[model samples]
Target: MTILFDQCNENLAAGNAIKLFADYKVDVLIGPTTNIPALPVFILATYYNVPLITWGMTSSAVLDDSPRFPTAGILSVGSKRYTIYVQ
Candidate 1:
């Protein structure tokens, strides 16, 4: 499905967007749709316990499940598992 996220100062806009998706009961967040803007939504997803698919996030840090980022995925490519919210 297509959802619109407005273009604005990302720090404010993207942070507020968490509520918009939550209101719609969105099952998964596909992207901020780009690499850079994805972080704010990633943070909010962690906070809201919403599953985030960082299909664009190239940061290897997210793969670490060291208890530090308990909400991040542990899988790499070739895994059929999709994004899931970790608690």
Candidate 2:
């Protein structure tokens, strides 16, 4: 398997992910880490028929929606559960 890395510049720039897909033609996408950036990238990965594995700070409940992100998987604890753990 080939691995490529690109920085999203800590922003919600789906353009970076687009460039990777268009230029490198990656089969799978691993994450933006943060919830905000991961959101769009996950959608893009699904559109491209690629799987997106999310980790780190990407704990948005929205990411848990299998219907929305069928090809995506979240490795981090979800926000709701994390909150419960914290409290």
Candidate 3:
């Protein structure tokens, strides 16, 4: 399966994930840049017809707001101490 990661800031983490996917013979695509917008992520997923996964706080907000995301997935990798207050 092909998976796309959104707004990946650090190369080290991204690279590690990519390597892992490669080991499993899965196709992986990182975001175009480290600061990709939510809109672009949606567009990319639509264009590629692949699932999108994101990490951290900002990504949580995007996933929560995007109800129509096609195969869009989010993996919350933040610490358990983090809490989100949505008003």
Candidate 4:
């Protein structure tokens, strides 16, 4: 199991997560930025056929009805939920 992290979460959060995964013999990849298009991650995961997991709030701007990527198995955790209002 490998994990990917974005720049915003590179402090203690990243350290802890990496340690946890390492304990389980899982490799981790920390990206410089989280705003990269989900396509790359999706493609990489699809090519490798490995499961992907996210540990922070993804940009809600990209998660509307027409999401940028397929979120079938993607799991996200955050303190607050994003509210959408349609004009």
> Best TM-score goes to which candidate?
2
Query: 1-87, model 2: which lDDT tens digit per residue?
Result: 444343545343487778777888887877878877788888888888888888888888887788888999888998867777899
- Each model's backbone clash number: 0, 0, 0, 0
* The 10-residue segment with the lowest total lDDT in model 1: 78-87
Q: Which lDDT tens digits does candidate 3 get at residues 1-87?
A: 544443354444445444434454434333333223544554445555556555444343344444566655555532322444321
lDDT of 1 by residue, 1-87 (tens): 646663534575475556656677666665554434555665676777666665543344443333543444423431222433331
lDDT score for residue 60 of model 3: 37
Tell me the deviation in Å of residue 5 in model 4.
6.2
Models 1 onward score TM values of 0.52, 0.76, 0.38, 0.35
Write down the RMSD of all candidates, one decimal each. Answer: 7.7, 3.1, 7.8, 7.8
The residue-by-residue lDDT of candidate 4 on 1-87, one tens digit each, is 454444454353445444444455434333323424333543443344344454344443443222333331334522223442321
Maximum-lDDT candidate: 2
lDDT of 4 at 45: 35
Candidate 4: give the clashing pairs. Answer: none
List runs of model 2 lying over 4 Å from the truth. 1-12, 80-87
Error of model 4, residue 25, in angstroms: 11
